[model samples]
Target chain A: MTDPDEAADRRLDANAAAGPLAELFTVDLTVAVATCAGCGNDAPLAAHLLYADAPALVVRCPNCAGVVLRYASSGSTLRLDLTGARLLTVTLAADGSVGISERQPHRPP
Target chain B: MSFVSRGFAGRRRKTPPGRLPPGQYDVGDGFPVLSAGPTPRTALASWDFQVQGQVDGVRRWSRTQFQGLPRESVSVDLHCVTSWSKFDTRWEGVSVDTLLADVVTAAEFAVAFSDGGYTTNLPLADLTGGQAWVVDTYDGQPLEPEHGGPARLLVPHLYFWKSAKWVRGLTLTLEDEPGFWETFGYHNYGDPWREQRYAGD
Candidate 1:
């Protein structure tokens, strides 16, 4: 159940998950902009809340408390769930700034 | 071992003595509050626990009825999948054994579900005997909502996620269906001693 009125925890943010996600994607996933499927709130993953103690690294939208990403690893197996993210726009400029183009998942809206 | 980044700024995680499990640091005196969702505020009047699925009949208990059941005090260690453990914490609650005593069931697996739509899978054996409880009090005080008030499942032997917070009920199942975290790659049977934090571990 996604609660739009959920209060975000002040102590934790996407930076807590940035390191592990960087290891997984080799690029900083927190730098990408994720649009929340629950409420269409567009924010950088850095603005999301990290639920650090879960079995997976759960990144939830700050606006709706809906999970935006779930990353988990067990030994050699790694899984990433982006079901809650409606769109992810990544900018891969050499300076790592400026959105030249946006890459959303190939799923219909 | 946990996948901690460089300069991980987690606080108060000091290394405790031999009482700790592998890859775990003690969060002494600090009861860490970590949840996948917002803390649910279920009032005691509306709160009820049920034992259903694969049972002969669903057994329901109102809050007053559950509180009236046989209660026991427990002192146990809690190991989180996040690689932190708290030692010798005290809790009071009705045992799962006592709750299931009158219910007839031949199910082999169980899924403990909570108020905020969280669920975790467990072998029925892990939930039976004196191993688990539906704890309502912690350190002799009514459990705080952040710490899963009203009642929460306490399976001290497994990693803390198996101890579902704001727990509402258990469903016995013939199939070993993975619940919430288990479907997401957490070890189905989270035995902290074996370091079963993830699925393939």
Candidate 2:
């Protein structure tokens, strides 16, 4: 079996890719809430495991290891994939402070 | 437009004379090993390759049986989504066409499942026509486990993550299905030239 500590050491949090995501969106992507389409797990993007060693940024669900988002930027062009996410909710506060809701919104009857 | 930070610029080398895709830097020698999971130690004796799902029937191959299949050597450029491109990487393996020659599938997509439960999906069209291979040797050496030894998918045109490491089998599907990284947020169809690394691209 592989060493758990070593594996953890190689992985980075989704926040590490925030700079690229911030360039595309007005708010920070790490603060956004993402729902994983694979395992139905909903959490803040910052909580996801991110692998940044490649030419692209790969974000996977901490629960199921499913890729949540992949962002690649080349020059002025930026590619963002959110197919693995059922939904991403980002709230902008009037004060300009980005608000990330930890709890997933309850479905209305 | 290129955001090569001062620190990153310090590490930059002169671009080679070939046609490289945008935002890609040439990294000479040494293919980096990056994995999202533990490197599985799969013994050859216990290793088998399978082709199933959306096919007429399941096809299986033992290690020896797989190596017995027609082999081809290819030299191709590898582009990782991380912005590094390795040129003229040579590999030897059976083409996906050879592996699926006997199996008839109406499936439009496939999910490459690997030893460590890692997976990446690709369109069925991408696996044929000499586009992809199940390579086991790199630079004439048996692939090291860290580098997805035994065998791994090689789809050079797309981001390297789409070329899953430690590949074991492919599950064909009538509809598109996201693999391990795809489920997290990787693009469904990764075309590096178009920079289709993500969904919006």
Instruction: Give per-residue CA lDDT, model 2, range B133-185, as digits (tens).
Output: 99999999998787888999999988899999899999999989887656655
Q: Tens digits of per-residue lDDT for model 1 on A1-109? A: 1433344332366767777876578666766889999999998887787777656778888887788889877566778989889999877877765443452332101
Q: Quote model 1's TM-score.
A: 0.77
Query: For model 2, how does the per-residue alpha-carbon lDDT over A36-68 read when each residue is reduced to its tens digit?
Result: 999999878888878786546778888887777
Q: Each prediction's Cα lDDT score? A: 0.84, 0.82
List ranges where model 2 is wrong by over 4 Å: A1-109, B1-18
Q: Residue A23 in candidate 1 has what lDDT?
A: 59
How many backbone overlaps does candidate 1 show?
Answer: 0
Off by over 4 Å in 1: A1-8, A11-20, A26-49, A53-55, A61-64, A72-78, A86-109, B1-18
Score candidate 1 by DockQ.
Answer: 0.32
